[model samples]
Target: MEFKLEEFTLGPSIDTLKKCKKADLVVIAESFDVDVPVNINKQGLMELLIDKLTEKGLFKEPAPAVEAELGALAGTPAPLQALPTQTGMSAEELKLTLRIREVEVRNRELEVEAMHLRLKAIEMERGAAVAASPSATQSPSQSPHDSFDVSRHIALVPPFRESEVDSYFNAFERIAATLKWPKNVWSLLLQCKLVGKAQEVCTSLSIEDSLKYDVIKATVLRAYQLVPEAYRQKFRKCEKTATQTYGEFAREKGALFDKWCQACKVETFDGLRELLLMEEFKNQLPDKIVIYLNEQKVVTIADAAVLADEFTLTHVSVFSSPVRREPVSTDRRVRSPNGARRNVTASASARETRECFYCHEQGHLIGACPTLKRKGQIKQTKTPAPINLIQIQPLSDKSTKVVESKKAQIDSVFRPFISDGSCSIVGNEKSVPITILRDTGAMQSLIRGSVLPFSAQSYCGTDVLVWGVKMSVIRAPLHLVQIRSQFVSGEFQIAVRPELP
Candidate 1:
């Protein structure tokens, strides 16, 4: 534990302090006139001793012999003769302890290196500020490049990342400005840090163009597809990620928008407004419409609007209904049996004047009158002979064939209703067997009260049109009825008629 004062004029090295026990550390501390706190641990005591000794200019650099020994220990196992015997520790234990301490020392060295780098960065920043200031003085012979250390300044910049090329360049530019790095050497510094695709892009350029930082940066960005269109697309499609906060997403979107604006060279308010309006217009349009506009290479808003309107008009015409027209009469006059000329409009006038004899309705004959039919008062009537009727010739074979074909077409178009099935209506004390007609087109089912075996009590009366004849019918609540082998239990309308047709 005792150290000779002459040999220890410069205090023991960190390695030597690490190897010593607590008692040895205390002895070393005393020799250096360093205070030893009673509560201090071995590690703390060593640090205190080292600090005090170094402050007093007593710290010593490791001797050549110690350096050689450390190198040997790191590369190969230590010899038994070199292991300390006074510590009462085995050779293996001491070697393990030394290896662990070596790791700890390496870690501390890394930490110290980081601290030095940070301090160097701070100094560079200060120097840059002073050089930029108007009040600062410098000799005419001295150049700004004299203090510009490319290697050191480059070390402060992060490596180029393919995925984050924009961000990496942003950081590079900031650091270069703070360190007062010469613009002429920016491309060289950037070239050194390029990796992956960025490196490929830089290497692909000619040496002359490669020397220009702008050229190199533009090439790199273009190679990565970070153009104005790309930025705009990213801004439009950027959605908030689950892991990202709203603030982060907003800032990211803003950054992308700025990059897009810069890339597009939108400097003035008008240019920015036009660009924004165009993008918003495209976004608001349907995907198909947007694609159509893109395919047509529409540049102006007016052109897009015109094309959209044309497309809409064309499609609307395709699906629109055709206009219908009333048939025009070609006949102007008719010839009578005596060769007297008569007007065709006179017959139309006679038909307009004609009225139903039963109900006095102008539009229909007595046979077709709905009131007479609904009242069951319709009767067959003979047609009176005309005072001045034209003698009509027999029908032509062609005309008779045309009439028969028309009648057949009418029969084919209108489906005749047939009795679907038989059903029995059960009343208070009686049941009636009736034919069932299933009219899918009819909204409500109606039963003739004249056909019912028992009397039906009318509840609420409603007007129903049967066979183009309006008639009053009442809703009759039937308890149960069997139809088509199925029991139907619901309300049924009972039409009060004289008899079933």
Candidate 2:
């Protein structure tokens, strides 16, 4: 749409109309920024504008060729024949088709990739049947894992989904890395054998012997759990048998441990002896020859609790009883049929030599080392500021010199206070502190009191009233009755009822 801008000057009236026609008016059409009102019938304004434009001869007039084209558009070309390709088959159209083909090819590729990923996931779940061979290259069909008839493989653990296995494998891989074992756990194929090897490996590791033992123990247990059910019992039994008590086998090997214990230089060798008595340690023992020669009584719960609170020996819990499951009588009764008499070694070859933390170690507690101790070396001693100390004087000491002067002030302040004689004071081993009331005005003396021991308040009514109040037989006459403080805790007395004034 094109526009022209027009400017005009208007005359005032009919008299100036003649001049308006003769006036110089610049007229040009200009485009106006207008949006047609939507959701309303603005077609009426358009119709009126069209008529105006037609009267002004500014409406577009159809050329003969345009009229012919419009007539042809009304009916000439068949729908199929009028398709885009009918226009001489342009290269742009061919390019669009090729682009569509590319999209289809990409979709097919994605489908294939999706299948491959799916298969990989299945392998991870069921434990990937990886084709690892001594040869540089091996076919997937000939893979050791594939040849591993999963049916033949013992089911050590319950079956899990692909995703679950994937998650487990991820964690397994991480632990395997730190333990620095070969990355591929083909041992998983030989689950029981793998666990057995794990125990050996952990035992063999030179670094952090205790920690290594724990790792190997944990790893072996975990691996055992993953073995097929057929292999599990056999594996456990064999593994456990392999880990048989030292008392059963390796008698000669026991000698070395005994020698080592001697060098440890334990104070009494009592603690070391008790350690040998442990079933687990015995099972792992070098031999039966190393039975505890002299053992001390094992620590009790109280002892273990103290140990835990003071140190980080978390293997034992103080709160629970130390479990000593004595192997049943059957094992003991099943002795050698030959009935050969065994000679008791005359004495232990142990001599206290090297210092262990438990024995001669200085400056450090058992299980704690100097390297681990945190240091805060700056030490300063400062005298403590005085505290607000208050001391009570004996009730007998009327002239007690109070360390704090406020005591004298308090005594003077309470001097005028009158008593209604309704309270009592009681004492255990100590006498009750008394404040004497001075009301010397009346002929009858007034006494106000509460029971010395609140607990004996009932007794004041019963025991005291019956017996009458007595202070070492210096009984005051039937005096004013103070229901509150009648009992002198030191004396057994009955309350004296006095006549009301």
Candidate 3:
């Protein structure tokens, strides 16, 4: 179709180009001599084509409506002949031209709308600027130095504490920043919230010093003894309170430690701060845990704390109660002389029939035997079995003679047969089955030294009296054991008696 140069110069709108497929857009860009890459997508090709066309002056500024201009030119006289000749276009070219004109008109309308939006934004910004200006809010006669009523805002500040001067100041600074309170008046505002010793310190300051917030703060902190040494002490002694969560306690401890470092001016040096923290942390731990951390050669406070926590967890688990065991049967089975098994109610019938070993009496155990008490008062003439002697060496010949004489006297006293039971001692690697004697007269449990494993380290020395003879014994640490169908765990004294069967 034939077209005027003016028609071709007016390029297609972005919307029209967007409606075309990637291949069609590429073809159009090639016609306009735009350098569009072969791999470019439809939208990218369209943008490149429009930019190239505009740079080359192919897209002209849109004129007034083409339909009105054409109608005005086409008079009633020879209108049909003048329309094609004057425009120099066919029906199809005229339709294409009219479509291009329509697109340009729409683009102009969008540009005008955007301009109006930009103007609105600028006006809104100016309004906001005016609203925020102090001059706009205040009357001409009002001075800029007028005092803000901070007393009304005193509720926003947390109450000052004599013990927590640092914490109170931190909270007050944050509240002041939020309220936009002048720095010069911060001391005045803070004074309203002070009480007790804090208020006294503020009042004692000179008027000039009181007006200076930093001066007032320093004086108050000094009065409360919140110095570097105080912070160090607080950090060292910090303990988790019952009501505080673990996270909260950890944060509080960290804050105190930071304060100590800052006050001492060692915060810039990590090595010094870490050393101080590690020492303080070690002091709070048990001696054993501290030793373990030292053995691990921990370099940082965090690593030491982690190791200590792991050790604590493992230690606690060792003492914690084992899973709930099913109730054990109190009933016992007795093998009669005829080789027949007979069920015995050990908890009821057996207890009623049982006799005390000391008195050979029913309804009571040897612990409460009346005859046993009399035996302690009335010396027995019967010779007792040779007692196991775990004696400590006497310092002198006279003391040695006295110990021998005491042993001879104890040999004459009557000794009673004690009840015994069998149980296994569980260790990290293996279990050792050992027989345990239940001495009703003795106040503590005792075991043979031979029964304990060589690896066992818990040894507490004490003198135990068996019958009338006093013997030295080593107390072993707590151990878990399987006693019949149930687990038993506790500490036991180790008596070094190889002579006993």
User: Any idea what lDDT model 3 has?
Assistant: 0.58
- Determine the C-alpha RMSD for candidate 3 after optimal superposition of all C-alphas: 30.7
Tell me, by TM-score, which candidate is best: 1
Q: Which residue runs does candidate 2 get wrong by more than 4 Å?
A: 1-70, 73-501
Better of 1 and 2 by TM-score: 1
Query: For residues 337-383, could you state the per-residue lDDT of candidate 2 as single tens digits?
Result: 23333222111111122233554555333333443343222233222
Give the winner by lDDT: 1
Lowest lDDT block of 10, candidate 3 = 75-84
Question: TM-score of each candidate?
Answer: 0.29, 0.13, 0.28
TM-score of 3: 0.28
- For 194-239, candidate 1 gives per-residue lDDT tens digits of 9888898788899889889999999999899997768988998898
Query: How do the residues 163-233 of candidate 3 rate in per-residue lDDT, one tens digit apiece?
Result: 67787888899988988888877877788878998888788888879778889888887888887668878
Q: After superposition, how far is residue 483 of candidate 2 from its true place, in Å?
A: 99
What CA root-mean-square deviation does each model show from the true structure? 30.1, 31.5, 30.7
Q: Would you list the rank order by TM-score, best first?
A: 1, 3, 2
